[model samples]
Target: MHYAVYFPLVFGAALGLLGPAAATRLPPRPATWLLTVGGLVAAGTTLLVLAILTATLIGGHSLLAGHLHWSPDVFDRSNPVPAVVGAAAALLLAVLAVRTAWAAVRSVVELRQAHRLARTLAPGDGELVVVTEPGPVALAVPGRPGRVVVSAELLRTFDAAERAVVLGHERSHLRHRHHLHHLAARVAAAAVPLLRGLPAATSLATERWADEDSTAQGPRPVVARALFEAAVRTRGAWPRRGACLSVASTDTDVRIRMMLAGPPRRRPLLLLTTVALLTLPVLAGGEALRDAHGLFREAALDAPMHSTPHPTSQR
Candidate 1:
């Protein structure tokens, strides 16, 4: 039982180490989905293992009262779990609880802040908002009736083709709800420190997704050039908002390189590999918990009886 509790953590660490390589091999859409889903599953399984460990500790303590006659001698046995291990599990569970709460509260606060900012943006025709700002700002703000905001400077800076590319990119983000995916990745990373890099990877992938989308509407070079020009023009000038998904959020150099290379081909093998990696740990954890439950049950049944009644003399 004690050893089983570590499986999820070990798997999470392994995924964290290997996930980047996997993401690189996959195309934008698959890569984004893979990272987001994998991070979520890893975090969820880690918490499940922690919960099982905590429950086992509580159950052991209750059973010990009957088995060892309320004596501290129960610690001498090492079948169910050692007292030292249980104590450590309790401490870890406490820390995880606090961390999870903090992450949830922080996510809520950021959402509220994003909504407030969205309210302040002046409405424009349809989903477009042309902010009268000097900076070359362009972003997709996600919410009910999501809006694509472009600054006055941005409109004036780009030509017709470039503007079309920009609109296509931001529209892709709004249509696909890329911000939700980003938010989920962020929350998962916050919950599981091992997956801290996941959010960044997903962000890059989302940028690529939008890039591909824009390319569908125009020449690849045109879209790539638009992204490069926007990135350069808006460098160090755009406002950082939690609620807005911007066209220039990812690494400009990487995006340029990917765009120049053209859209990636689908790699089914990579997807299969990623699926296997995610499934194995969950199955192992479930099997371990099943075995641990059986062991605990047997231990309970074998506990020493408090007293034995003398057999009555037979007639």
Candidate 2:
């Protein structure tokens, strides 16, 4: 029961922490691979259904065929309850995987489109600045004079400190190449959807990282304040749609709360957590191997042991 619960959770945590890094690095290609390969994987799923059917026909599990068998037990038996529960979990995970992959795909398309548009949209060789969006929006379009955008609404909503913080946030993002981080993150996820959370965590961390640099002017709260204010004012205004920072879809509450709280306090606690995160896979793999060995041992014990036959000399 403990393994049943904790196994997936630890797996999820691993994905959560690792996902963002991948998302930040190679987002689009990974996402595309996930979609294509995922589709191919779906085709192979019939093998699972066939395996289950064959299992039912063979009258339960066997090891070494006639040489070994496992004693039936409540948990050891192929009960429908566990099967149903497992199926449900698999389904949920599949949905999550698909959603995350799609998001990466879309982000890639949008970002690339933004890049192409930047050429035509370029205002000619100065620090990158955007003027189209009405609300708060910040984008990093590559090339010297690489622009960092902020919506008019954002400027109207925030004080000078907050506005400066917002600009700085975008600047930090550009300077640190957070977009590349995002691409990496997406790539990792596309490579493995079970690792979806990896990208998500990275994205959150990068956003925070950018916030830290942008708000370095005295109070970091000013940056957080700007993010919250922008989200509230923009209502999820995507720049492609002629709008900037729209709060319509942003995690306004979460961003604001983080702003108020400021950055997380670093402590040795994170060291322990990092250790656990790094070691969890090995632990999980070990546990799985242990369980498999145990099952096999039981099967071996149940099967008949052969006695050595004595060879008779010519009598």
Candidate 3:
């Protein structure tokens, strides 16, 4: 509960939100690494504090009893402020640790598979089919091949230029390796649960990020038209699944708005929000520790027990 411990844990949680946000706006290369490091540090700090408190409680209780005797199957438990605070710290650390572990596993599996999948397709003069399914679709799978997959039905959905635009859109996804960003954001969030709000923010940012990437090639209307047409054609699966893992899965309204808006404001708002929110838990934890320590010192010696100073005759 010391400020040292609280600040790190809270800050870790706050930092957790940043990765996803950054993933959306920035490419995965630098941003993902930064977020991943932050999560590791935060989780480590949280676990360290919990471990310390757990050790203190176990040792303190044993010393109080002065022997290792199991209590007789007791149901009622005594309330002690230090013990309660210690327990809470321990629990919080445990949850964060578990989250980190699960996320680590997920990151390794999904991203590796996606990357491997990306290797299967190499875009040439013609398009490819990365995953076998029937629908109007086009998306990028990042790798050396970096597929611009299109379904048979999708080829008939639009004219040649529109088809090219659709392919261009998916190509932009591959160029940016947007799927990797999504995967990293997901993993980082799992690794650090405190940044729960991050995914939504990052998802929004990346859509804008890719929209800008697409517009750099041609007019926004071209990409917009292609997106709308392709989306409508595959309206059924758009709600349920990822089509060939190329299309950047995003909210319809948000993606359309980004296309219309033409890019982000360049404000560091999400990052700033993360920084501001992370400070809170850390402050609370530090204060809690200070208060607990001061209270212990004040109460430990102030209370006086009744004492008979004079020697008494046999009675």
Best by TM-score: 1
The reply for model 2, stretches above 4 Å from the true place, is 1-13, 17-111, 132-136, 142-145, 240-250, 272-315
RMSD of 3: 9.7
CA lDDT, every model vs. true structure: 0.76, 0.49, 0.55
Q: Write the per-residue lDDT of candidate 1 for residues 82-166, one digit (tens) a residue.
A: 5576577778778877877777777667666666666666543377888888778888877557778888889998899999999
Ranking by lDDT: 1, 3, 2
The candidate, 1 or 2, that scores higher on TM-score is: 1
Of 2 and 3, which scores higher on lDDT?
Answer: 3
Clashing pairs for model 1 are none
* 171-253: candidate 3 lDDT, tens digit per residue: 76666666655565565566456766555554555555555566655678777776666666655542232223434455656
For residues 220-297, write the lDDT of model 2, one tens digit per residue: 555666676665665445553211112223344654565566555544453345445444544554554455445445
Residue runs of model 3 more than 4 Å from their true location after superposition: 12-81, 119-132, 143-145, 235-248, 268-315
